[model samples]
Target: MKKRSHISILSAVLVASVALTGCAGGNSSAGGNNASGGSSTPPAQTQPSTSGSSGGTAAPANGGVIKIATQTPLSGNQSSLGDAIKTGAEYALNKRKEEFKALGFDIQLFPQDDQADPKIGVSNAEMLISDPDVYGVVGHLNSGVAIPSSVKYEEGKLVMVSPANTAVKLTEEGKKTVHRICARDDAQGPKAAMYAKNTLGVKTAFIIHDKTAYGQGLGDQVKMQFEKDGVQLLGYEGITQGEKDYSAVLNQVTAKNPDIIFFGGLYPEGGILIKQAREKGYKGYFMGGDGLDSSDMIKIAGPAVEGVVFTSVAGDVTQTEEGKKWADEYKKTTNKPLETYSVYGYDSMNVILNGVLEAIKANGGNKPTREQVLDSVHKTKDFQGQFTKVTFDDKGDNTNADVFIYKYDKEQSNFVGKAQ
Candidate 1:
């Protein structure tokens, strides 16, 4: 896959690179302001990231430079999200650069491109683990990519703060080294299932998967939940990735006259399926997870995406005080629109910086070792971030964070947040 030098050109290959490599050498760097310490004047309208690691016994009052390694697809199929995640993360990192310096510390992110493949994701995790300068890591946009890659970080004793990975298994077993800034697929699956059964009042639902781990896992969860809740399971099927025609599956699905259809897959294929289903006159509501939450899905599915429902984390940050500020600066800096996971990227980076700054303070204005940084992250509590009030549960899931249901309004060319 061809790697675009600018972050504005979004693609899955770039995201794949992110899923696989951490801090590996990449396309030319995009340079920007890197001054450290608090500035007398805050940029107009934008409050710098208001994040602090509260109640961590490991962090002290003194501070110094903390290194955070971040991995994302900087060059492949999922680059749209990878680029958005990077842009938001960088914005937060820059805004708070001065604050950390005042506390006696500086922060830097060693970004790697993973290409969004699971194998590459694992490789990226190993690379970050090998870097003694790296304190903690953030990334792997796809749950399929995160599931295996996270194991490496767990063994390395380096905490992995995921900005977008939603697979339940990543944290459900109580992996202390893993923390997710978003809601899990299990929760989202049930949320969507409930919406289908109650809101849409669907009696029969057709479920399908793209055969990827993320695709199959969420599909199975929603399928089982729907059946348990007394909804008829019309048919369940799996489709091969990158295939051109979905008519075979859609044909069977249409024959079932299901009240709704659920696809557990990313936007690329999900969009195509929605388009195909519409062409076949299968008019029931089509639904998906965060994987289907993208502007491009509308283009791919055309008018078919209209009324399509999907779930997301952090809602729309542009609607909140802190969210609006970050959104404006992100647009200003990257000269590009923010996507679904941008706020998550911003929050995840803040989480890492909070721990890093605290660790440095505890160390008396000296650079913190990687293990010290990890300890700081584990000890973090009640840290407030721009998008959500963050406090990880015993399972490493963020507590009290809100998840949103979104409907694609094709005429408006955007996702309209819906009440669940």
Candidate 2:
């Protein structure tokens, strides 16, 4: 097998850039410091050239079918986010269809709606893994759903790469088949807490979660970080997800007069909480994790969500030159502006597809086994895609990951200004 050193090459480049920037002793401007690091020119987006002819290994006697499955909530409250994941994955597959066809394989996408429910996600996983053609999956947007579903994938030796699952436990469980392209909540939570204390100047905070694995885990991470930073916690609560009214919780939170309110949940409940909190006279800053990154937050909260800030595991891809091109293509293809996780979805699918190609090459153009594909993915390093350079650690977490903060700008009618 050919050994690649792209991961080391990128790491050295980043280190040298940081060293040079430090020697200059100049502060990065707003546009220069977009995310966790100062802006540096990104490498051009071009497919890596393939080497060798299809010879050594046994060629597939006949053309085969390769299917990539996506499990997300295509209906229910989180459908907006689910739809973005589906669109992003589908876009990547569609763009690469010709390439796969040239390799004597027909690539197809099978998207299953899990409704953000663990049981439903597990069922989807069972169905996907049962099909021999379904070699990999690109989804399960919710960590709660992903955790259970990934178990089934592991049992079946099917690779499951996530674009949006941020909970620490997802990658920490030591499952080789489970991998994520996004930063973990532990990394994201501290940045958000620091922003609250130093940037927002919030002295006290009230925290709430939706009681799911993603929500509760992220909320705990933020809470721990905030307490360490000397921010007084007025209250910490978990509410039922589908409840229509939250006046009782808002009344309680308002009584404490917190300087900021942080909800560790998705847009559906977070939006209502913000709206009701504003209506009940709690004029404080609101913050959340990537679960609240969807435009639905603003749509549901209306004017109340103006100036609301959230931390996303994925940064603003549109800011980068390559990202702008990708954004244009995505809009032209999907007819909708790319959401926060859409780039992540695109990147995740590319990672899997890249691994599949490598696996095929390693087998000398023969149809590779599921285990070969899994091994190829495990060896991925510095696999550049539209979102960012991906290099998964031993724990299946992306080592180059960083959390970015974005604020909803009512005037601009969009989220602007990425902050570390």
Candidate 3:
């Protein structure tokens, strides 16, 4: 088990950069200053483009399978997450397969398990690139997977819509090719940091990461925000993900005796670490990013997950109108509820298809070339999504989305949204 502090420090730098910019102007939106648009905006109005029931203008039959690839953690420590992603995408495709057929095309989803490792993610991305049929991709649940995987897709002119990857740098430069439907780590990190400071009233905190790119990046972001708010950072460090035992790290966190502990990583490691922390007599707020929001965490942490807090970008997407319909239909078709990245995965399909549909209409229903589809995705603006408005800035990130905070309610056996 190896731990490096470099990524943790990088996250701190991310916060400092935002804070310094704030000093130049009275703007507070830089480092989590409550920028969630007040709920005055009405739900967005983008409609599905299914063909008319009657024999309407049929799309020119291309008779080719359009592939949408995914790189996820399907069979490793992160399999829980990978499974969610695959299910979500399939749900979306199955629901809308007819719509695509009506448009004279057949769309197929291609999933690859990256196992939450960067090297494997890159390998998977290259394999997808070699496959000529893959027009767009839907995943790489971990930010570490998304960051590098994106480079290959971008060079290959493939549209990438990330349902869960949320690191800031992924879309920082306004990438035209890579689009993310979920909020980024910077968004989630600041929201969690603010909750700890203003809502939880925590004065000192211990921040830790799993030493992976995503974990360390989020840990750094939270630490920087805590420091900006003048909260005492008792200690900050990194841990190795997938370690059998975290007793040594738990011993250190317990000695610090901080009011809260912020972990930046996924469930398999988080579940075990939180359980160990509680067993070792550390009673404080335990929190992490969306990676720790899965039901499996409760299974692993057992009673220890109770009262633990976490932030998620995908706010129980089933709560939205479109999400509800999709869940109902998915269960009717597959007898399962939408979970994890399902909302994001489905939403990604809607967005990419929306772009594809619009592109075909613009070109008079001719078979759209990959370049046309790529161009269409770039022009996506103000499309109504399952959870919220699905518009991207030049950086391939959502424009006005909110991060939600949830606490583990043992009584409910799930993370319940706190009444903010």
Candidate 4:
């Protein structure tokens, strides 16, 4: 991929302003003439007397730290997705360490492995909240894991910004501390359904879910949309995840001879289901949601993954110049290419870090409380980043994000094309 640089003068100005204005006390204000029409003197400004300073002379405050935790599956079938998110977030933090330090604090990342299980996710959430320095989170890749874990964060008044969780209820109930950079399943499901009917020209479709909260919820949304579109629904079934043999269910689905098969589950089971479906002589098109996005899907299903399609809440960031530069740098640093949710991870981390910076500025370089950071995040509007312009809605979801459809190319062993 080609790499290019796009400079942001606004970011440079913001950083300079924060560093220069850090030493000013909270009560400092611009002076104005009094009612007597006499000259009013401005308050004396304190500046960091560091060598890096362009002007002013006061030492910046020290001894404060902000720790952000990542709760995601680092081991197991879904490790690819989790690892991608971790890499993206860590990259963002490392890239902005100096800028954050100049604001009188150090940024630290504490990643916990959720193993894509709700129980484990809750345990990880507890561990994260136990640390007083931990004020923000950047994970819980699976909606099933995120839903249960967010309750813990909400109780602690800690903010969590999700990069991949898309269940509607995660944002629907108005959880103040919960926010996501990705579009909801409610948005993605209808888009996928419409593509299946109008774009793929599929007359009948069968829906299957892994029975997890993420899977079942997405499948139900897709089913609802498909029904509303007046397409023939062959069947809607739920299967237990981590089961090796899906031949029994495949046989039942094959009997219907549906024009399309949509699986609402992670790559592990989705790959296995696709492999088994092809093995059973089912030749119809296979479709899925973001859960089927990882390279592991192709590795699991091999040649059987040809012509499969899926919906992702994120577009191909590498298509843009700034995104390409980021992707190239990410590959050089981690020796791994960016995955579907990596940009979401980068954007989510940026949102959190920006909020922290804003909170610190609001407090006149003083260490901000967790509640202050959460409030800053809630008030974000038109915050531009590499992926998109982020503005949180009343429900804490990104108001401007969109969904994209991608198809797997068997010849290249990768997904290509961004269809909106």
Candidate 5:
């Protein structure tokens, strides 16, 4: 391993010599970052609207189908993460569906693919609102998509519980309908910066963003904190989303020889950047935000991804016995391995469903309106979830929202504990 590290450093020196020459061609290098960012994602809108029941005991008139939607990307680049969130919500609703069934209501999961596109997200939001059956939505992995989609939700008075979307604007817009269980970019970014500055002990940093809402937003925060911490800012750049070659920028990054490279975007771009940068002999440490939470990065970046640390809004669920059991069940239910956001999706869905129950109770065992469900969710206080507890402030942001850091190992990323 030491020999390989030395060889890798030598190779970097050799490559650094020629990096500038090939940068203009833009063919020699790779990578951006997202929540994933189809190249981003969010949880989605699922099944129809309905009031909730308390412990299957509430005799709420008749049990009709209560559709809760998860609005996340199920296709495209970020699908790995998108699907993860969807599956979590799916498991949550499916597990408790019987409760609704006993209450004479069929609780169904309605997952909508925002495709990580803002326009598509808004359209999906409109469609879910029109359905009237979709009471609450669980998605959008991308903050860019989530922001606009949230506008539609606000206009329709539909409650949206996001498992991913971390941009501050998602909640700061004064949109009462928007809520996220995850920490915002402001909280996530600074802690990541602190980790890089204090934990990683980096002195110089290079910042790169995907040029999208979530990516740029997160990048800006990390940048502000890094500068505040007296870390030398090597260069701040933006990469086009969905692009394959990032050699030009990689060359710039390699030339500067910063102690660390920080990416603000999702897994798709992040993976490529790490892989390509490594292949091109950029041996510095790389870090990112929750957008790098997906395990798919291991496949994309291969051995190069080893030791890549990141800050995620989602916490490790396997740490606790109940969470460990839930993870195993998640694998059994989906016939697939669990990803980081799975617990988050599950919790977001449960929050919405819990709100439904409260709404039903508040309405005297009658079917409640979307407004009631919205009000109930907004009033959420100390709601215990499988992974974390939630209490939405007036801004619909989780009050206990925290940022956790993790580093990629041989098989997958492991939790390094909470950053803040």
Candidate 6:
């Protein structure tokens, strides 16, 4: 990787770097007007990054600077999960900074706030792509954002390792730069349907989606599978995001009086819907996908959030001894609640850093190009991380991807084991 050294270019890089401060260290620097992101992206390396990590003084950088970015919703209603993803990626980078330093490189994190919007995500992708120091990116909780943002990443030859994009269309596009550690909606939706029909013994259902790529796509999958299982489908409808009142949709759903209500959206709306549904006197089972995995739902819906079941690509880390230790340290370090995608974010970044490390080794202990890192990441096999065992298939989907079921009770999203 060649870095620009011209005086003007270096000055511009420094100014833009100052303007674009990604979230790290509980806010060491201020961020911009909107979304989780940095400003203009430059290919050149600047003075030592001010990520505000607690690590010691960074080692000398003889091999230029290498940056790994995280693109997630960091400053919105969904920031609960999105910030965790950023923090997890930051933690992974801090742990391996010394290793990269030993290899004559200084590592830094560039987290972007997608704001759960495709247009903003695409704009952030362009900024990330313009920067030459960035090689690998880990992020994108929403599959809609990931799909379009990935097109930009491919244009720049930047490899993106996503922690929580579950839509099937993401990897089916034949783009070499996009990859995700989580399972797809095709798997997640059907698994959720099976659980609803077989385990919960539900025969009739009503579906409500948030009218986005992730929510609608997952809802369609569940509807298809539910029909196959001979379950009665009372209603399948869409709802707008960012709206407080859902009385119109609630009236339609309550009229159906189905055995279960399935929502294919995030926690903010999921909480409001179920909270209002209960108040509307619709006493039926409630289920959803991973978008409801955040603890914020409990806060949003209060007692109404209990008994909610969701399927997630991430599993409970505290079930293992090492995972428990990591979770404890994470809480103590960041003072943030441990969301499910946090471990996935950590694992995804490690996977990217592993690829960067290999690219360096292959480059004879020097900086490697983004193409080299992309190729290295595509060849990952049986690489274990904090949570999942990852192995990317030819299409960039993880072969070891598995879905886990969770139940919310007593103000916790308790792991109900893997979805079989």
* Structural RMSD, model 2: 12.2
Candidate 2 displacement at residue 7 in angstroms? 15
Per-residue alpha-carbon lDDT of candidate 3 for residues 1-420, written as tens digits (9 for 90 to 100): 001132233324433543454421110000001000012222222122222222233343344556666666666556766767766666666555554554446666677767666667777777777777677777868777677777888777888887787777777755568888777777778878999999999999998887766777788889889999998998888777657698877788898899999988878778898899988999888888887867778788888888888888767755557657767876576554456566667667666766655555544444456677778777767766555567777777778666777778763335456324
Better candidate by lDDT, 4 or 6: 6
Q: Which lDDT tens digits does candidate 2 get at residues 1-420?
A: 011244233324433443554422110100000001111232222121121122122333234677788877777778887878878887777766555544456666777777677777777788778889888888878888888888999988898888888888888888999888888888888888998898999999999988877888889899999999999999999888877799888888989889999988888888899889999998899998888888787778888888788888878887878678878988887786678788878888878877776666555455678998889888889787776678988888889888888887653234445546
TM-score of each: 0.81, 0.85, 0.81, 0.86, 0.86, 0.88
Backbone clashes under 3 angstroms, per model: 38, 0, 3, 2, 40, 4
lDDT tens per residue, model 4, 70-184: 7777677778888888877777766665655554555566777777777777777877677788878988788887888889998888999888888888887778999887788
Consecutive 10-residue window with the lowest summed lDDT within model 1: 28-37
lDDT by residue for model 6 (300-349), tens: 99899989999998888899888899899877776777888888888898
Kindly list the per-residue Cα lDDT of model 1 for residues 251-332, writing each as its tens digit. 9998888888898887878889999998998879898877886667777888888888887664787776765776787787
In model 2, the worst 10-residue window by lDDT is: 26-35
- In model 4, which residue pairs have backbone atoms overlapping below 3 Å? 47-58, 48-58
Candidate 4, residue 368: lDDT: 76
Q: Clashing pairs in model 2?
A: none
The CA lDDT of each predicted structure is 0.67, 0.74, 0.67, 0.74, 0.78, 0.79
Question: Candidate 5: global Cα-lDDT?
Answer: 0.78
TM-score order of candidates, best first?
Answer: 6, 5, 4, 2, 3, 1
Indicate the residue-level lDDT of 304 in model 1. 84
Q: How close is candidate 3 to the true structure, as a TM-score?
A: 0.81
